[model samples]
Target: MSDAASTGFSADWLRQREPFDLAARSASLALGFRAALGPQNPAAFRIVDLASGSGANFRALAPLLEKDQEWRLVDHDPLLLAAQRSEITRWASGQRWHCHDHEGGLAIHAGPARWLVRSQQLDLARDLEDIDLASCDGLVTTAFLDLVSAAWLDRLSALLVRTPRPLLASLTVDGRRTWFPTRPADQLIADAFLSHQGGEKGFGPSLGVRATPYLAAHLAVAGYQVSTQSSDWHIGREHSDMLLNMAQEAATVATETDPSCKPAVSSWLADRAADIHHGLLSLEIGHLDLLAVPHFPVVK
Candidate 1:
C-alpha cells in the first residue's frame, strides 16, 4: 500500500494527528466483544489485531480486559510494533499510576519495539498463515479496512469466517466530504480520487463511503451479525489541515484518472487549499467503525 493509504497506521502525518486516540472508538467494540463472549469467566480471551500499527488499538484496549488475557498484535511495521513495545514497557514499568490494568496483570509482548518502523519486515496479511486460527477468541483491526479494496475485504472476510473467533473491525472511512462545511465541488474531487485509489488497489473506484455497508453485507452473507457506528475526528486546526491535504491528494488522483476532471477539479482544489490557508474553509473527516461477531451456531 502507498504511504497515503497506510498513513492512518504508519505515516507521521497521522501519528502527528494522534491515531492512538482513534483507538478510543474501540470502547464500544470492546463492549460488543464482551457481549459476544458472554461472561469473561475461565480462560483469558485471545485477540489478534491486524495491522496493529504502533499499538493504537492495544493502548485503548489494554485497560479494558482481564489482565490474563493475551493480546497478539500483528503489524507489517516492525518500527511501529517496537514503538508499541516501548510504550508497553514504559507503562509496565510505571507504578500504580502507569499501568492501565495493574489489577489484571496485563502483559505487553513485544516482537521488536524500538527505532524506525518498517513495513516489509512484518507483513501481517501474508504472515498470518502460520497463526493457529482456532485458538484465537477474537480478531481486530482499526482504521485499516478503508485502505483495502473490495476484493481484499472479501479475502479478509473469508479468512475471518474461517477462524474460530469473532471479528471486531474498526474501519474509519472518510465521510467528511458528505457532511458540514462540505464543498460540493471538493466532494466530487474526493470521489474521483477514491476511484483512482480503487484502481490502484485493483478495485474499481467508488467504494469510499460505501465500504462499511459493503463489508457488512459481505460479512452478514457469510453468517455473521454486524453492528456499525460513526466516529468523527472533530477536526482541530491540525487535523483539519491534515485532512485538507488528504482531500487535495484524493482530488488530484481523481483528476489523473479522468483527464477531463483536471481543468475543473484542479482549480477547485487550488481554491479550496487557498481558502483553508486563509482560514476561510474547513471540513471534518467522518469515519465509520464496524463490529462483526459470529452468531453462535446452535449446538443441536
Candidate 2:
C-alpha cells in the first residue's frame, strides 16, 4: 500500500462512534469563538474545514453561526465529501450553497450558489498553489494532525502565517486511552495493542507519546497561539460490544507484529468478548481536544 493508504485512517472505524461523541465536545470550544470575536458580530461568516468527514464539525458549527454563513467544506475522500454535501443539503435546505470538487477532493459551496468539486489532495506541508488564501476569513479542522509528520506541519504553519485568516483547529489525540476505564489486565493488553499498532507506521517507535505535544510545538513554532481542552467518552457495560470490536482490531495489530504478544492479547480479548456477551465489561475512551490559531500577520 502507498503511503497515503497506509497512513490514511478511516473515519468509518468511528462507526461504533465513541470518537464522534468525543468530537462533538469540540463544538463548545468552537462556540467560544464568539467571546473572542465579540457579541455584536454579524451572522454572516465564511469558514473552511479541511479533511471534513461526514461534516461532524460542520453540523456542530452550523447552529452556532448565522444561517447565512458561507461554509466551504474540503476533504480528500470522495465518499466523505458526498456525505457532507448531502448532510448540508438536508439540514439547511437550499439556503446554503455547496461546491463539490470531487477530482481534488475540494468543495467550495456557499448559500444558494453553485459548487465545484476539485479532486486533489492538498498536502499541508506543501505550498497551496491553487487555493486563494485571501478569500477565506476563518479556518477549521477536527480530529486531524496525528496522521501528519513534523515536516508536514511546518509547511502548514508557514502557509497559515502567510494567510490572513485566523485558524480554529481541533485535534483529538488518544492521550489516556491506555489508562481509561478498564481493568489492569485489559489495560495491559490495550497498551500492547496500541504499541503494536504504532509500529505499523514507519515512525511507529516514537509516536506513542509524540502526537499531541508535537503538534502544539509545531504550531507554536509557526507562531500560532494554542490552547487545549480534554474530553472523555465513558461507556458502560451496555456498550462493551462495540468496545470489544475496537479492542479486537487493536489486538489483531499487536498479535501480528509481536508473536510473543499474541497469546496474552488473544486470551485477554477472548475474555473481554465473553464479558461483553454476558454484559460484564465497561469501557471508556479518552481524547484531548486542542484549539490552535495561526498568527495572522497584520496587513500593513
Candidate 3:
C-alpha cells in the first residue's frame, strides 16, 4: 500500500514489498473485520480502501472476505490508480479467476465469489471527507497511517465514529528495526531514519511510528473497540534485493539527516552489501495492524 500524501511511491517498490506485507498482516484481524461487517448481503458487501496504491490491500483482503464484494480504491496518485486494474487483473488471472473490464473498472470472478473494483483519484489530505464510509461495509488502509499527522488521525477517528464501520489498517510502522550481526553505526543509522520518517510527507509533520497508538486512543475514546497486532517484516538472506534496498534507503536518509555521518553511513552500507553478498544478513522491521469497530448497543 502507499501513503495518501503527494509524495508518490514507486509502483515497483510497492510490488517488491507486497509479499512481505501479505505475510506480515494479521489474518485474525481480517476475520474480526469480516465479522464486524455482520450478515450483510453477500452480493452487496462493499469496502473502501484508502491510499490503495496498486490495489495490494484489495488483493490481500478479497479472498479472506469470501463474499461477492465491491471495492473502491482511493488514492492521490494517478499513476498508482492507473496501475491498479492491471495488477488486480494479473493477480486474478494467476488465481485462475476470470477478470474483465466492467464499467470503467474491473470485475473479477472466483468461483462463487465476485469482486467489483473501481479506482478514484482523491487527495486524501484534502478530500478525506468525501469518502462516504456509511455506504461501505468496511474501511481499510495499508502502510498509510504513518504518513499522516495526529490531527489527520483525529479527523479519521471522528469520521469513523460518525459512520460506525469496522476498519482494518495494516502494516503501520512501529519504529523497531533489527539487523542481524549488528554493527557499530546501527543505532546512528536507525535514529537518522526515524528522524527522516518524521519529516513532512505531504500530510504536515508525519506521526510516523506513533501513528497507530495515537489513532487507537482516539478510536477507543469514541467508543470503538480497537485491537492491534504485530505485523513486522522479517527479511531473510534470500531476499537480497529487498535487503539491499533497505540498506540503501537507510544510508540515504542517514546522510540527509546528518551530513557529517556520510562516511559512517557509506561504510555501513558497504558492510551490509557485503553481508547480503555472503548471505549473512537478515532484518526485521516492526509494524502493527489495527482493527477497530464501533460498539453496538444490544437490544433487550
Candidate 4:
C-alpha cells in the first residue's frame, strides 16, 4: 500500500503497512547500501529520500546506518510532511531515544549517535530537475518507483549519471499476487489490479511491474552498478485486517480497470472475506528492491 499504486496514500494506510514493509524489505541490499555509503567516513552523509511519506524511509534506515546522518524527506503532501516530526518523535520515544525539536527539524539522540531529520514539500513529478542530486551523498525511495513511467525513471538515471550517488529504491511491485484457498477468480482479479497499476499515478501512466528492471537498465547505461532482490510481502492469517483491506482495494482497482470484471471481482472479495474470517486466507505479493551505484568514477 505504498505510492506504487499511484495514489497519494493515506497516512493511516502508511502506518498500517509499515510493519509489513519492515518485515518484507530485502536484507542484502541494505548491506549493499551500507557498503556503498560506508567508505565516505569523514562524517555523516546527507541522504535525500524521494516521495518520502511520513519519513518511513528514515524510520527504517537511520538505525541501520552507523554514522550520524542528515536526512531530507521530500513529498508533495503537506499533511504527511507535517506528520513526520510527531510520528518520528513518538516512535523514538517508544524506543527510549531522546528526541528534540529545533528551529528547522527534529533531532534524535540514540546514545552516541544523533540524526537530524527534516521534511521538504515538493511535487517530485514536476520538480525532479529542481532537486540538487549533486549535493547529497545518496538518494533513497521506497514503494515509489512503480508509480512512475519509464521516461521519468530515465530522467532520474540521467541525473545520477551526471552526479553519481548511491540509490536505493525499494519495495516496488513485480506483478505477482498469490492467495491461499486458491479461488478460480484470483488470477483475474490480480490481472485487473495489475492493469489498474498502469493507469496514471500522477507520473503519466506508470510502468508498474516493469519499474525495477527498467530503472536497473537505465542506471546501468549511466555507469551504475545496479543490483536487485526480491522484497515480497507475505501476509498470513495473523494480518486479517490488512489482508481484508488489501482485498477490498484490489477489488476496487480491478473494477476500475475492467468494468466487466466487477461481478467476478465482487465474488472473489466475498469469498476472500469469508476465508479471512475463517482464518484460511493469505497472500504473497511480489516486490523488488534495487541498489545502484556508480561503477565508473570512484566518487571523485
lDDT of each: 0.59, 0.55, 0.89, 0.86
Candidate 3: stretches off by over 4 Å: 1-6, 297-300
Best by lDDT: 3
lDDT of 4 by residue, 1-300 (tens): 534333878788889888889998887897788788864687887889999998888989888886788899999999899889888998999999999976598989977888999889899889998888877888999988988998899889888987888999989999998998799998888888778878788888799999999999888877789999999999998899999888888888888788897888888889999999999999999999999988875463
Off by over 4 Å in 1: 1-11, 19-26, 87-128, 174-184, 202-209, 237-244, 255-270, 297-300
Candidate 1 lDDT by residue in tens digits, 182-237: 56576676566456545443233325556788889999898888888777655444
* Alpha-carbon runs more than 4 Å astray in model 2: 1-15, 22-28, 34-43, 88-131, 178-188, 193-209, 294-300
Residue pairs in clash, model 4: none
Q: Which 10 residues in a row give candidate 3 its minimum summed lDDT?
A: 1-10
Q: Is candidate 1 or candidate 3 better by TM-score?
A: 3
lDDT score for residue 171 of model 2: 44
Model 1 worst lDDT run, 10 consecutive residues: 111-120
Global lDDT of model 2 = 0.55
Model 3, 57-164: lDDT tens digits are 999999999888899999998899999988888899899999988888799998998899999999999889999986888899999999999888988988887778
lDDT of 2 by residue, 1-300 (tens): 111123554545433452445444656667655333333554445567776666666656655653345566666666666565555455444455454445544344455433332222444333334455566556677666555555555555666677745556664446455423455566555555456434433322334335567666767777767776665566566776566666676566556656686778778777777777888766655556666655555342
